[model samples]
Target: MPATGEKVAALGHRYAILLSTFIGLLLISNIVAVKLISAGPLIVDGGVFLFPLVYIVGDVLAEVYGWKASRRAIITGFLLSALASLTIWVVQLSPAAPGWENQDAFEAVLGFVPRIVLASLTAFFVGQLVNAWVLVRLRERTSGRFLRTRLIGSTLIGQLVDTVVFCTIAFYGEISGWDFIGYVALGYAIKCLAEVVLLPVTTRVIARVRAAEAAAIL
Candidate 1:
């Protein structure tokens, strides 16, 4: 009982909010990703567009806290994503009553594609961990110099891996070969650029959070 209590306390202190945010982001992104959309000439795929923010949040957690915290976030995100997919699949497969003509369409939209599911969850888990790890290491290596560089560079690296893995997994055969690669590359670039441009604001928010945490510690 004591050990269990201690473990719970530790988890609550170390990662309650980060885990919550990660799960929230992952679940919501999966739901939104069911429908693809467009902004201008860019074809913004569902879930992919909103999912970038998870990387940013992962960065914040890692930069201010540490890799372990970020890792916890990643794991939590992965598990929740899987759970969400399972829920969708279960709900989609269950029988629908008469007068429900849209049931088939609903299932069609929400049904899980095995390859895409594996690819998405795998890519995000691995990519987010890599992003957090790189950012933390770079910060230490540079002695905290070039904050923007670390933030942007880490995100770019992570997003590239994520895009390739997800696109290849989800759309490789369904899309024309050339279009598949092009869309993945374009999506990665756009997401990375957005993160880079948001660096200053991210830095400010991180600094504030760290200060608050430090004050509490002291």
Candidate 2:
């Protein structure tokens, strides 16, 4: 059996993988968010598909690695996302080559409004932190039982914060009345529902990860 220290090192190695996936999904979600897609009667940003995965991964991190590790991952994702946005903003501002004809296209794809960027960053940071915090607290309260409850509860709260914050800041005046309410409601509902649908898969992944980490420790 490996020593406890060796096991911890192994677990940390696995964490690195989870952290990378989390950050990659986050950055990609921001980039794709430039486009809005219609799902039935609802309109939501393109990022909706991948964005919720971040929370699912976050739940795995918090449930297995604990809140501190999850917090570190969240902070890392935030800084890296901000960096990506800044880099894109700079690229968008730089003078285009005289013969270049795709500047509009480039901007259309990569350039995001400053307000939207601000809203995304702010919402992501707050929501991720809340997710980790809530999961950790619930773990403590429940003595680590009822993984489904922790996952679902934290995701519902976190996605709500993310949707409301992002929508209010990015589209408060632009979308009013029931439209605004529908937008927020749809986003939150979809995210929560996604979590519910993926619960079984998440349970399996968490179990495998925990078992692997335990074996490594032993």
Candidate No. with top TM-score: 2
**TM-scores vs. true structure, each candidate:** 0.87, 0.95
Candidate 1: the clashing residue pairs are: 33-46, 33-47
Candidate 1's residue-wise lDDT over 11-37, tens digit each? 456457756776787788877776878
Q: lDDT per prediction?
A: 0.80, 0.89
Q: Cα miss at 211, model 2 (Å)?
A: 0.8
Model 1 RMSD, rounded to 1 decimal:
3.9
The C-alpha local distance difference test score for the whole of candidate 2 amounts to 0.89
Best by lDDT, which number? 2
After superposition, which runs of candidate 1 have C-alpha atoms over 4 Å from their true positions?
Answer: 1-15, 97-101
Candidate 2 lDDT for residue 106: 95
Scored against the true structure, residue 163 in model 2 reaches a CA lDDT of 85
Error of 2 at 195 (Å): 0.9
